[model samples]
Target chain A: MDFNIFLETSISIAIAACISCMIKICTVTLNMKSKLDSDYFILKNKLILAKKENSILVNKVVLCNEINSKLLQSFFEVVKQLLSLQKFIFEKGQ
Target chain B: MKKKLLSFAFLFLTSFCFSQDHSKIIDSLKTVIFKKPSDSIKIKAYGDLCWYYRTESIDSAFKYGNLALKLSKETSNQVGEAQAYNDIGILHYNLADYKKALKYYDASLKIRSVLKDTMGIAALYSKIGLIHQNTFKLDSAIFYATKALKIYEEKNHTRYIAYIKSNIANIYRGLKQYQKALETHLEIADVNKSINDNLGLTRTYNNIANAYLFLKDTVQSEAYYLKSIDLALKYNYKKELAGLYNNYGGILHDMKKYLEAIDYNTKSLKLREELKDSYGITSTSLHLAGLYLDLGDFNKARNYLYEGLNLSKSFNINELKMDAYDKLASYYAFKRIPDSVLYYRQLFKSINDTIYNSRITKEIAEVQEKYNSAEREKEIQTQRAEIAEKELKLNRKNTQIIGLVTLALLLFLLGYLLYNQQKLRNKQLQKESELRQALVEIETHNKLQEQRLRISRDLHDNIGAQLTFIISSIENLQYGFKITNNKLKGKLTDISAFTKETINELRDTIWAMNKNEITLEDLQARISNFIDKANISASNSNFRFNMDEALSKELVFTSVRGMNIYRIIQEAVNNAIKYADASNIEIHIKKKYEAVVFTISDNGIGFDINEIEAGNGLSNMKKRANDMDATIIYKSQIRKGTKIILSV
Candidate 1:
């Protein structure tokens, strides 16, 4: 009788272990899926930020270059007038 | 007119005086500049020439700078224009025309400031300051120098700071503020010492020597000059060496060591010639000429002075022209050529009046204001970069916080699931243990039930055998002795009959106890055996037992209920046999509505059931029917058959 009880206990434990393993497998699969979803969302957000930064940098560069272009234009205008004046001075001196 | 045309030719071929390969490059550029259909390329070629000739030949550098500037304006190439102006300014500065140098420098400074080119603006500030210092405009020089200093300080450009500081020190020396000049030079020397900038250190030493010389500290001046010379030679700072030799020669001249001064000036001139520093050659030649004049060598003196004059005229350098004119006027006077002396004197005065205009000071002030605004713009850019970096860090921190929270929640959920699983496992174990206990209790009850049946069977068997023996011994005594007493014999016979009945009751108990259940067939078989014995004992009457076809097979009953049903049938049969005087007796068994029906009838004279008291046999049969939960009926008539029916 004791042996029978031991055998029954062993079988029960085996069955319980199988059930536990199945539950563990389900939990693990759910955890993995959740982790993947979390990581995917985080990465997607990071990609968006990177794209935003890239666009911002490009805009800033364009703006800077545009301003420089305008500045250079004004500077050259002044230089042209100065050169013409110098030419008149040289001609008068001759 | 011939001199102007010759100067133009020399400016165009300045590369020829430098590297032969560079001359080829310049030739190609000149061809491209004239022939290329693209105005942009023409401008670039012009700019290239200006850059190549800036150091080698000042007049060529000026011509190219002007050409590039003109083409850049035609093409609207602002970068080329800015570069051309800067190059032209440097060329004129080298040519010793401080007024023209400041004009070109301001133009370049305006463009660079508008472009927010911080380094370029700072460099232009230094150049403009140098021009002002050259013209002896001390206050205007300090303003531009300080403007450049602020920009370099904001940019943290250490090397450029030291260079600008050296220039400021030179300006201080020109102001005769010896204390301020020495302090600025020391500051520059400390920076150079920290960064190991040997070239900057050599220049600082030279400035310190000049400062000491102006203060009349000859010992300190000579020691610093030697230090400057030693470093310049070791590092091969040829440009600094040339300037140092000229300055040292001036000190020698002040000391009235005319031969030594001439030797140093000649050495300086040789180095300038080797370096192709046309401005240095002109200035040093003028110095050598004056030294020879002081020493009474008129032929050598005129040779040096005229060479200096011709070179200065070719380059259009006003500073060198002024010095050459002064020396020539003195020489011509010494030689008694009054007409040449008056012409050179008038020329010097005309150039001086042209260079000293205050419009130049106003322009320098305007350029300084432009640089200040550009500096503010650069500061805004730095602030924007810092804000962007902070935002990026904040974004990273937010992501880290979200990741950590997700991890913590996941861990919590995992822990909850594990805890639930453990609880379920413990509950299942408890249920299994309870099931095991129930099975043990059931097994124990089954064993006790089996023991009870065995004891009942043993008691029934032993009691039945003893009762049978008593009946048989009573019969044997009655037959063998032949007793004559009727009452005693009758009583003995009654006792034997009682023992036989007791034996039958014991057998029924044993049968019911030995089996958990008894079949209707066993009850039927026992009834038939009693009928057979009754026929043998009472041969005068006939008895017949009949059963229905449904009762041919065994009908099941519980052991206790079967015994009760059998006893009821046996009593009915016995009562019919003893009380009825009939020729025939019949007992019939049938199944009716799931109950067993038994009928016993005798063909004989019978007493009325209502007239007689209830007999022990009849009452016992009713009691046994009640025990079996069955029904019994009896009917009899005078000279008619009697019948009893039992249904269970």
Candidate 2:
């Protein structure tokens, strides 16, 4: 009986807390909407600035990939030329 | 004594017309209406004229009021239009045209509601209440008066609350709830006093006196009547004075004071005529006739009875007309004229029966009005409940959407972190493999270089000495001997030159076999040495190399893998010089997310990756990168430049 009473009280407190949180979340969320459009997750200026930084990072990645590939291609050409040169030298020496 | 009473009565009754001549005001207002300064001003001036001529000339009042209504509508001044309609309703109400009065009041009410003019709405409701009161629709009267009182109370329009409450008190009196009427009137009296509204208090006093009269407290009734009369006379409220005098005369008539009743009724009738209070005039005329009959003056009685009947017929006052017929029957019966009495009695019965039927019809209407009002109240409650339910549901929906969105956001963040972690682990593995491969290459190169060094030493210490001796003997034979074949000498010279060239070639082969394990510092030094060589060869070009601060200088790698990296770097630098016409070149190695990233870039004319990637240009590089478990990405555009990133 004591356990039952305690459980009931605990359940009531939990329900009360849920209701309070719902109300507070609504208030905070609505306050956020008052400043920003619904589609966005952040302030206009902050989102724009974040996007700008992301764009720069993307450009850097693209440029890096291009440079790396160009470098690797040059190295492969040198290796191909060296192998061909070695085959000629071995054949001619024999 | 008669002259004194008449003079005093005249003085008090002289209020509306005597305060100022209404004709002069009407004429001036007429001129103002013609000279249209502003339509709103003209509408107001016309409304004033309507009020001024309401009691004086009913026809002129309606004409000017309609003009005001027309002008207000034309200018789209809804407030002025509402006021005009209210004035017109009052004019109709004064003439006892209840149907027209109610219609105009409804029109004004619609406008006031649209405008959200609560004060104007309350006033129209009070006026409608008065119309219902006059028409004897007591239920509707109380309903409208209560509605008006509630609005007035809500708005804290205290003075107007007393007015509506006074009207409600009168409705209670009509309902024969005399005690309730008396209580309401008493409260209203106090409210009027607090506001210093002497005229409003007088109306309350009159209602209280009537309630007392109905409750059989004649002394109390007379006392309240006198109190009301004193205030009415002081304020010269002619309509209120008229009502008070008639009611006081009723008390006097009951007390058998025929002469005093005649005096009060005379004053009431005179004032009623002045105010054009049609119902008041009809009632007072009948009462005065009854008074004259009580005085045993047949001539005066007959004359007043005829006057009352004519006015009642003209105004369609059927209830008072019946009373007039009854009184005529009594007058004829007192004259001992059987035929006249019979005629009047028939008239009375017919009119009374007609009134009874009309009263039944009116009662049906009143009941329907009450039922409709209740149904309207019920419908409003249902709508209110529905609206509240909708709002609660909407709020819950918003809460749920927010909850789901937050949950989704948390899930997405978790997913992103897991993916990033997997990527980091993969990069780490690839970097380790790349370094391990470099270690393998460096070890293999070292072993091969050791074999080459041993072979070269063997050639230099043993076979080179034998070759040197052979060469010297051949030289001695060619120099000491006198005669020799030219072909044989040339062959010997060819052998010496070939031996010397073979040794030089061996030295070159030994030079190509070099390092064992490579460190980060060694790689940097090697790259710098290569760049220095390139700069000397391609003097106009510049090269730069950068290493991450977090990368250790002593980080070691295998010979073959280091050799591969070195060869790739050399190949890339050579290509940049040979093909790219680039002015500057840069190589950057950094630790990113626990993975080592190598970026090779140049400010040169770039190539299209779409045109480049489809070719077999990167096949060997890709194969080497796959062996090391390293990933390489190449990006380039024409004139933008080329960049390559290797992550391991």
Candidate 3:
């Protein structure tokens, strides 16, 4: 009878140990899932911020390109006027 | 009368020098300019000389072109200055100095546009496109080529139109747009033939052959190649002929006619050598190496490959050197030399890394150039507008919104996918852990049941039988007293003595069974006992097994883990006996480098390690070593038994 009790106790202990291990695994998995969700949210927020920044940069580049074109055009026009005057004088002299 | 005769002589000589040809005209003009030291005539003479030598000698052409530029600057002749810049740009382009060529081309374009020289601008655009094509910027090449084509078409310049068409075709070929390339080449070829332009026709034929080759139409490719070759030979263009031979060799090499390929490549190599063409030699050597490799002559292949690699390296030709490294790696792999294969693979990787970086640089340069050119065009148009009204505001606004929208969409998708993947992974891990726990529980329960059954059977078979025999003996003793016989009494006494001895043996068995739980100390004691037995057995030879004194008595040993360690030691000992056949053995166990290390060494007649097969026992040892995440090394030499070292 004592041996039977011993066997029953050992079986019960083994089952309890398995149940505890499974609970630990489930808890760990749940913790990991929460951490992953948090990380995802952080990354998503960062991506949105980066997108906003990129849009601003693109706007700035476009504005700069436009201003640069205008300046170069005015500069070229002045130079062209000077060149025409010189050509006119040279042709009139010839 | 003598003075008049001398004057006539001088006048005739001067007129002859001026009227002979452009080169003679340039020479006489140079002398005149040297005497007078005037800028206008000198610039004209330098410009003419630059045009004359443009195709023949790039250095001299550039030199004279620069001289013209300087003279034009002194005379304030913008037209002459622009022409000189264009000539210098062409010379640089011919020399493959694209960066410098682009600078000169841009300078000439600026001057030409200022002077309203539309033809000059168109020509400069063509030259820029040619530079882009040579640098493998196919899209930019096509853009400029098309711009030049439009201008030439508007001016009704048929010859210039044909040239632009050919340039566009070359760009298309570079882009692998075979159908477009072929159509353009055919149109250009017809125009050139109609105009009786043999030089242009030969180039067109070569372009056609390249397009057909890209289309994999070998017959058409060969036909056009032969036509180009014939024209090249007839015109005595050694450079073009060399290129033709190399192209033909590549085709034959692709066709698997190695001998013919080698023959053609050798011809090409000879021509290039005569021409002092280092780049051509690098390419031809690579083709020859391919031929040798295809013929299965690895030694010859390696010889050519290494030669090509050295030449390419010396010339700083990264592309050809990369090819050579790839071929060498393959050859070493085919030869089954693992070390050589690994070395050449590393070389191949380094070369590829360099090529990737260079490609990225090339891409960035191309984009920059396109952006700059577009900006220049915009600047030109904006000069005509009085008020700088912002036309790009709407475009910028639209682009910003589009960029933001796309980025938002991409980010959302990425986050969604990542979330889903994480959830899936967690589910899988949970399931795996659950399964593992179930297996462990089932195995432990089954083992316990088997142990109990075996114990029950042992008690029933041994002790039950012994007790039954004692009961029968007592029953017979009672009968013996009833009989009252001296002999029967003596027999009963013997039976009692035998029964007492059996009872004592049963008690001892029970005690041994109760002592079966092993402790750490008990494990160490058992190992020591085995070592002592081994020492006595190996008395003829010197043997030592030592454990570190620093080992703690509190060190726990699970039976299963302990059995594995014992088995590993046993296998090592058996291997030493069978393979090492050593006269001396030393075994040591200690902690080192954060690991427990077990070492066994012997000095005996060792066999060639390379000849030993990794049999089942060795495989098992390796697998167990892996299970423990341990490293095992067996080192031996001839006439030296072996040393097996394990770190866990």
Candidate 4:
């Protein structure tokens, strides 16, 4: 009877250990979910900041495009005037 | 150009708003929002409004904080949301709603971590540290303060670093590490001075003073207190001034300077009231009341005690109320007002008991909450185990049922087989016993027949020889003597014939007794021989024997029946030859239905069977036929012929 009790105690301890191991595994899985949530939120914030930065950059690019167009038109006007003056001087010299 | 000017104007206005009173700043922020400024500008205004209202009105602060949060979410402003959460946390902290403060702070911390807002994160860390410090969690306070300090130091934010260091020093002081607390405070003071943070410097100095007081160095404490006072007054640091005055009053109270203690305590209370520091008011009120009570000014003590009591009730501060009650009891006793003293004493007892019970209850509730959470988890585990155990038990039961059924079937089959085997064995044994009995009976009958045959053969051999001898002697006597007398010769001849007849009968008896059964063929052969003999004896007569061809060769008769039938046939033939004096005789044996018919006829002198009395020969023949279970008839005729018929 004493031996039977000892065997029962040993088996109970083994089962408890197995249960504890499974519980630990589940807890680790839950902790991983929490970590992933944290990472997701962090990435989301980063994405939002990136979007804001992108918007600012887009605005600057549009402004620069306008400036570039204006500068090209001015350069073309100057070139047309120079070409005409050169043509007039060449014709008069001829 | 207009946008830049507007932004500049907004910054100027915001800077101006920070220096104004709470109501004015709130009004300015309202106007800014009313003007339909850009969403960003409006969000900023809301955030500022929340911070300004935090100490003055918690509800208004929460309202604006929520507005800021909503606007920021609408605009997708992560930084604005983080600032809103921080402002709300501060408001709760100032209102002494530490639990709500911690929750909001944690929310802010998460956002700030997400936004990578280092400065905001550091500032939140310090605030959280202060909450922990207030709750007497020194280890947690130190942890958070150290985290903030590390970040601030990395960013080269000297002012923030100094502020965090000062908080850490306060925790160290709470832990009773006065030397470490004083060293950290002194170091933070240098950093605060370097950054020209007069408010931070003053706070650091006040912390150092408290540390010195804890160390029992009154001179150093007094010097540090004076330095902190100078900086606090110069910078108009109302909060720090109130705290410094309270601490200085406590030191004076401890030093037995009653008047000084009362004056300092009163100043601290007035400043706390002006600043709306409800917690500070309760503390300084109790101190002033107790000091006045010690000075024997009953009215002043009573007034201050009542003020402290009312403030403690308003703020729900039990420690302050407990102190106020105690001081009131002492004051009434000093005045020799017995009834008033007793009343105050009872009041003091009641309040003390209430505070003690509330503390104990709060502690128990916290422990119970933890225990309940653990029990809930354990209950879930136990339920899972129980389900598994039940499943196992169910499976075991099913297996046991199957095992029991199989065992029963096997037992039933075995029982049936055994019963069938036993029945077969009993039948076999009964047959063997019957066979053995039959064999024994056959053996006994064979032995008895052998004994009977031996006895009959011996009698035939011996009796036949003796009869033959008698006949021979009689014949010899008659021949050899040649007797002249006729009667003597006749007698000798009769004796020889009689002996011859007896020998024939003896032979017949031996034939019948020696065999168990006889065939009809044997009887016929015996009867045919008798007829031949009769023919020879009667020289003037001829004999004929007839048998049915249809009589089966396999037909048999028992010994007794054969003997009886043979004798009946022999007697009939003899009677015909002897009595009838027949010239020729015929005998016939025929089957008629299941019976045999025997007939003999003679052509000789005949007599009527009715006229003649039955002699021994005829009677013996009839008797022999009866023993064979056969019917016999004798017939005779005169003149024409004599015919005898026997039917059996």
Interface Cα RMSD, each model: 56.3, 18.7, 47.6, 70.8
Chain B TM-score in candidate 4, rounded to 2 decimals?
A: 0.53
Evaluated with DockQ, which candidate comes out highest?
Answer: 2
Candidate 4 global TM-score: 0.47
DockQ, each predicted model: 0.00, 0.02, 0.00, 0.00
Decreasing TM-score order of the candidates: 2, 4, 3, 1
Model 2, range B194-288, lDDT digits (tens) per residue?
A: 99988888988898888888999999999999999999999778889999999999999998988998999999999998887888999999999
Least well predicted 10-residue stretch by lDDT in candidate 4 chain B = B448-457
Best by TM-score: 2
Residue B367 lDDT (model 3):
76
Of the pair 1 and 3, which is ahead by TM-score? 3
Q: Cα lDDT for residue B229, model 2?
A: 97
lDDT by residue for model 3 over B1-648, one digit each (tens)?
644544454345455753365456556555554555345555766776786565345466778899999988887899999999988887766555678889999999999999989899999999999988877777778889888889999999998999998998787777778899899899999999899888788888888998899999999998999999999889766677888899988888888888988888888888877655667888888888888888888888888898899988887777788888888877887788888888878888887987787798777886788788889878877764523334454554465556556555655655565566667677756655555555555455545544553554464345546544664655665665573656444444444544444443333223223332334455566556656766675665667788787765556533334444555676677666656666787888777866777787888776576887887666767766775567888787889677778786
Stretches off by above 4 angstroms in model 4 are: A1-94, B1-5, B15-31, B54-63, B73-78, B154-156, B337-648
Q: Give, for candidate 2 chain B, the lowest lDDT window spanning 10 residues.
A: B504-513
Q: Give the Cα error of residue B374 in candidate 4, in Å.
A: 7.2
Q: CA lDDT of each candidate?
A: 0.74, 0.75, 0.70, 0.75
Q: Which sections of candidate 1 miss by over 4 Å?
A: A1-94, B1-49, B59-77, B274-279, B309-648
Writing each residue's lDDT as its tens digit, candidate 1 over B139-224 gives: 87889889999999999999989998888889878877898999989899999999999999999999999899988987788888
Q: Which residue pairs come into collision in candidate 1?
A: none
Over 4 Å off, model 2: A1-94, B1-19, B27-37, B110-122, B136-165, B177-212, B215-238, B263-267, B292-303, B328-462, B465-648
- Candidate 2, residue B627: the lDDT equals 55
